[model samples]
Target: MHAIVIDDSSAMRMILKRIVTSLGFEATLAEHGRDALDKMDAADHRFDVALIDWIMPEMDGLEFIQAVRSDPRYDDVTLMMVSTESDQSKVVRALAAGAHEYLIKPFTPDAVAEKLELLGLLDPERVTAGV
Candidate 1:
């Protein structure tokens, strides 16, 4: 599976990339939402999933989710918010806006795996194997 990892912090992006790669996804990194969109638009490849940070420059994760969902070409892409925004309202907004899953910052690899499994993005064997 192909995934996009978008965040302003390079460290955070690296961590997310590592986690997703271990889960069997080939990842593309973006500094922010607009950059992510540009990368997606420029490439012929269609991503299977996007892990987005909420408070980013140029565009935020919520807006990115809306933008992706609005485009029919990206309809099949699963969007997951990986943010520090853990408030109930924010979570509600993200889900209502079209994010398939939400993982707050400081998450464990197991948490990510569980979320991916819930999204039907992870292979059962991989999850069972604790990958």
Candidate 2:
């Protein structure tokens, strides 16, 4: 599957990319929400999933999710929140705003795999998480 990693932090993006790649998915990086949207607009490819950070200088993850969800072209894309915003209300709000999954920051590779597993994007028994 093709996934988009939207985070202002390059290190975070790298980590996400590595994890996504390990899971057998292709990942594209975008520094912020606007850049991500621009890339999506310019590309012929549609991402299967979007892993977004909650905070950014330009546009935040919630805004990205809302924007993508509002557009028909991205209606089928799975949107997940991957950030430090682990507040229950925030998670609830993100889900209410169309996020398919919520992953807290500093997550282990296995946690990501578990989320993917629950989302049906990965096989639960096949995932080796601690990597």
Candidate 3:
């Protein structure tokens, strides 16, 4: 599967990329939401998933989710918010805005696998095998 990792912090992006790559996803990195959108627009193949940070410089994750959902071309992409915003209201807002899943910051690789499994983006056997 192809994935996009969107975060303002390069460190965080790298971390996510590593986890997704280990889970068998080929990932593309983006500094922020706008950069992510540009990358998506320029891609020859559509991404299967997007891991987005909630707060960003040009566009926030919520706005990015909305934009992606609004575009029919991205209809099949699953959006997961990987953010530090753990408040119930923020979570609700993100889900209402079109996020398929939400992962709080400081998550373990297992947590990511669980979320992907819930989204049906990861095979059960893969997570069980600890891949």
lDDT of 3: 0.95
Give model 2's TM-score versus the native structure. Answer: 0.94
RMSD in order of candidates:
0.8, 1.4, 0.7
Task: Summarize candidate 2's per-residue lDDT along 1-131 as a digit string, tens digits.
Answer: 88899999999999999998988889999999999999889878888889999999799999999999999999888899998987899999999999999999989888888888888888666585344
lDDT of 3 by residue, 1-131 (tens): 99999999999999999999999999999988899999999999999999999999999899999999999999999999999999999999999999999999999999999999999999998898885
Q: Best candidate, TM-score-wise?
A: 3
Residues 13-105 of candidate 1: C-alpha lDDT, one tens digit per residue: 999899899998999999999999999999888999999999999999999999999999999999999999989999999999999899998
lDDT of 2 at 31: 95
Backbone clashes per model, in order? 0, 1, 0
Best model number under lDDT: 3
Q: Model 3 residue 31 lDDT?
A: 87
Clashes in model 2: which pairs? 110-129
Q: Worst 10-residue stretch by lDDT in candidate 3?
A: 122-131
**What is candidate 2's local distance difference test score?**
0.90
Candidate 3 backbone collisions, by pair: none
